[model samples]
Target: MNKVIRIFIKDSTLIPVISIVLGLLIGALIMLLGAYNPIRAYASLIEKAFGDLYSIGETIRQITPLIFTGLSVAFAFRIGLFNIGAEGQFIIGSVTAAFVGIQFDLPWYIHVPFAVVAGGIAGGLWGSLAGLLKVYRGVHEVIATIMLNWIALYLSNYIVKFFLIEPGQQRSRILSDSSWLSSSWLSQLFDGARIHYGILLGLICTFLFYVILWKTRQGYELRAVGYNPDASEYAGIHVKKNIVRSMMVSGVFAGLGGASEVLGVFHYQTIHSVFPGHGFEGIAVALLGGNTAVGTILGAVLFGVLTFGATGMKFGAGVPIEIINIVIALVIFFVAASGLVKAIIDKVKKKIISGGSSLPTSQDWKKGV
Candidate 1:
């Protein structure tokens, strides 16, 4: 029994599970301080997120982009790069898809794929810029990605406003039916929800990430280069090439995420003053999932639930939506600080088993003299 318990504690999954619980507990404390009932708020959240078919579809719709962006971050992390520019890549992909979606009118099958591929390519090129800067100019990836994010944002705004704008509207022209990924059958099945085929595409991408990384020679080389560029170079691997490739792939995923938004959900592009923030959220998902393919998928689902339910929480339970953010922040905090939390837990367990009377003050102080 003790051995089993020890193994459970040592398991990789245990840390994330504990962190999630701890975050919820802390969030509950915050809710209490705010004079809100945490139990009622959480129950309402669950009800609105999964109670009905429509809600479930909304949850999956929310999960789709998260899966792509999470995989984008996780994929880059595997290759020793910090892709802070998934937002930029995402924006670029969205606009490129929007451009293709509006400019050409092809068959449904061809048009949909053409727009999606355009988004992926645009994102890949955008992501590769950071990689090029890192490998050639010796610029740090973090700094390059951060700058690229802003550049992508402004570039996207310009493309939409100056080039892609409709004659009389503020947003880009609505995509024709052929360009949409929406499934009539699926929407009917879910009682008129906006869930589309993009979720399936996202899942396919996740599977590809797993297979390419763990089963292919290219993936092996990429991982090798990531582990140690000097050693990989000695082993006849082109480290620079792999670095560029990884970033492009990362951007591809993020770009697809953006394309999913346009083709699957919004169906049009709007001018934006700020980044959509999906890239940064991807960082949180990657960290929570320990940067694994399956873990990232599950993490995205968890975040999706919280995000889709936030509205219900605000309206139904009168709880602030910021509570969800607080919980997410705490979960990341506890994951990052797992060792400290574990040490504290171990000390408490030891004290319980040993029946130790250890105290910071003296024995006399405890004796109530």
Candidate 2:
């Protein structure tokens, strides 16, 4: 089993190609249900997601937040912490970003990072609250984060209504012109859609996450603690401190997720409704992405395509948005039980092993190569 697992990780490319193929194959099976034409529904899905520049822009816009939240959730999972409060963190982050932008008048270069940091700090504090309770009071994070989400939601709504509300409307006041990320420059390729350069920022963050998670000693400790906290303690690691730090880092990612939306996409805080269920969907993105940062990015992009594609599934195939959900559910089912896929791979492995093959050993991973 260890040999097989090592091979799978080492061959990294196999997982992605397999995951996509399986998702589509299952989606095709659903189309055969007769209520909808499989070919047209899927064709419409493709056309809408990438058939035009406008839809591509929309896909990127929608995907931006998922990247941050997905990484946030995936990162926490690495440390054996299930960060269910990314939703709350996202809201809190967005509100703080709004507060900073509205309260200050700094230039773009300074203001943008400042706003993003404010959002991240707000989110980190919330995540820390849950971690603190778990570490000090024996509270389950699942309950604490859920409760915090409500608190954040209500508080954010109140802020939006009273403090951030636009002078004449219920929305937030328009951010300073310096804070706006969109410009006529982006119009060169994305039409009027606001797919700004922030996508690059998201990519940079994801890359950093990948590096930190796989290449750092602290990362190994977190993963070890996640798999078995007692074992990590035996190894002399401060388990509680690591837990708190893990949660804080998780919140930072969630906060970045919120900042990406407010800064990169919307340019203002929105009603909680606009961010409805994003943090939740991010869990699915994390899982489908294999709980790795790079995997999460691909999963998020795949999710974005499905979201943007499903509109055509609604219009051209007369299918409802619910079916898009059904499709996603089916894909998730297959990926979660990767054992089924592994079982199939066993056959190929045996044939190769018979060909005088010796699987890689742990020494390879320990090489720090």
Clash statistics: count for each candidate: 0, 0
Query: Per-residue lDDT tens digits of candidate 1, residues 2-90?
Result: 76775455435767888888889999999999999899888888998998999999899988899999999988998889898888899
Predictions in order: lDDT: 0.87, 0.78
lDDT of 2 by residue, 223-291 (tens): 889989999999999899888888888888888777667776777676665446678878878887768
Give the C-alpha lDDT of model 1.
Answer: 0.87
Q: List pairs with backbone clashes in candidate 1.
A: none
Strongest candidate by TM-score: 1
The TM-scores of all predictions, comma-separated, are: 0.91, 0.84
What is the TM-score (0 to 1) of candidate 1? Answer: 0.91
Instruction: Evaluate model 2: give its TM-score.
Output: 0.84
After superposition, the stretches of candidate 1 with alpha carbons farther than 4 Å from their true spots are: 1-8, 167-169, 348-369
Error of 1 at 10 (Å): 3.6
